[model samples]
Target chain A: MDEVKIIEIKKSVFADNVKDADALRAELKEKKVFLLNLMSSPGSGKTTTLIQLINRIKDKTRISVMEADIDSDVDAVKIKESTGVSSIQLHTGGMCHLDAEMTRQGLDNLDLEETDLVILENVGNLVCPAEFDTGATCNAMILSVPEGDDKPLKYPLMFTVCDLVIINKMDVVPYFDFDLERCKKYIHLRNPQAQIIPISAKTGFGLDHLADWLLKQLP
Target chain B: MHELGIVFYIIRDVKKVAEENRVERVSEVVMDIGEVSTVVPHLLTHCWRWAADKEELLKGSELKCNIIPAVTWCDDCKQEYETVKHGKTCPHCHSENTWLLRGNEVEIRELVVSG
Candidate 1:
């Protein structure tokens, strides 16, 4: 029996992603631009929350947004048309998540040197987005009231990696069976350091707090 | 959902390694997929099959995924527990000082090649 040679090549599939993310983060830091990676499930009010937050702070801050979607450019159009901020749409060509290199490509063309903040509205996915660091200074996730409280339990990685958890659609919380305290407890369990903010993009409730937090993060 | 994109990454990385090692044809690419990791094993395999066949170096190459169970380390109890079962809080001591030790790997463990 001719023995086949088995060569060992231990390489991380995501190692290149980690390196690119670190480099982009260093570059962003050097340029004095704060990058925020915002992630959530589709219909989690990520766009609405971003629109409201953009309207609130785009005046005082030199900020722009990058909308990432699997196919559609509708979100990017909405951000530009409604908020009037410089926006770019990144179509993943069929991919659901945005990795570091994808984000870097978006930032490279968007002109972030003069911008104070660059928000990556990562592809609407709670599971895959958290897996790759998109070279953002802070990672934020939106969990709407209608989405129920068990999301943190089901998608622990998204909650765990997030620095801030925004509970959107607070106006509809009374209608839904979502227990706010219980949801907060679940988020805290996975991520004790995560700061949870209850907000309503429809009613314009916590956009001020979210905007203020964004300003504070600018270094 | 984006397993196809992940497939592209695997192909790119595998090709780079093969080129560096001066290998002509790659037979197999083994991956260490974590249980709780975002990349689904089956979907990744499907994507790899479709994409690898197109590449000259990776033609008919097999993509093997080894599942790794997620485990969390409890700081208070100094013990390891299953992450999927107990979630974040340590069931042994109910401590919040627990962190994930492993099972989040999305790396290529080894590559099988032939001259």
Candidate 2:
């Protein structure tokens, strides 16, 4: 009989990212630097909200922001010009999201040793960005009122995995048909431990509260 | 969005594995992709064809995807249902207390090489 050879190799292609993310988290813990992976849809006021946050924390601690986009450094320029903080623009070529390996590379490019907090403004999309962990200490997402109350149902995975959910554009809640309570109910269904905060980047309604809550999460 | 970049990542992994296994060529690479993982299988293969041919080891190799169905477990009913169909609610119980039990995976399940 002819010799038979069969090798059974059961492995995951995306496994490296998960392991890498965990290692990165442990390293961040050792350095006492908090890394936040902030995600949201375009026009959800991610940049605006980040600017507000930078102002609130810059005086007390050293903060750096990484603006990731398919192409363009417009947000990076805005961050540096407005907040005067060390900001870097990460161009993902044509990718919609930043995976763990990509996030690690971005961190290496930034000044990790000198900075206290590193917030990665992930590519502005709710679907792909939330699917992968960016090796952050925590992950957050912004759901604008105009995005509707049914979003939690549509994007259950995003809501389920996020540590914090910020409901932005709350100032226009009256004009829009968004039901905040109903939305929160749905979010809790997916993630019972998730913290939902209502805020408006335009009016600075809940920036302080968000800042206070953020500072508490840092190591 | 960058299925091409994803293909590059796959090639890199396959090369490393082949080097470790002391294999001259790879016949196929099988991937288990969940229905809701945000990875378009067709696009992945499309990019795979373009990049895989460039490498000597993967010149004529094949890339196959095994689709994994998405299921959500309803906490209220203590039952599981199709996630893509029923979404967030349990179909049998109509309860919103549900979470995804499966799907959303992009894993390399198997690698085929001749002895």
Best by DockQ: 1
Candidate 2 chain A has its poorest 10 consecutive residues by lDDT at A1-10
lDDT of 1 by residue, B18-40 (tens): 88877788888999988877779
RMSD of each: 1.9, 2.7
Candidate 2 clashing pairs?
A: A13-B108
Per-residue lDDT value at A175 in model 1: 89
Task: For candidate 2, give the docking quality class from DockQ.
Answer: acceptable
Please identify model 2 stretches exceeding 4 Å from their true place: A1-7, B2-6, B74-78, B95-99
Docking quality of model 1: it rates as medium
List TM-scores for all candidates, in order: 0.94, 0.90
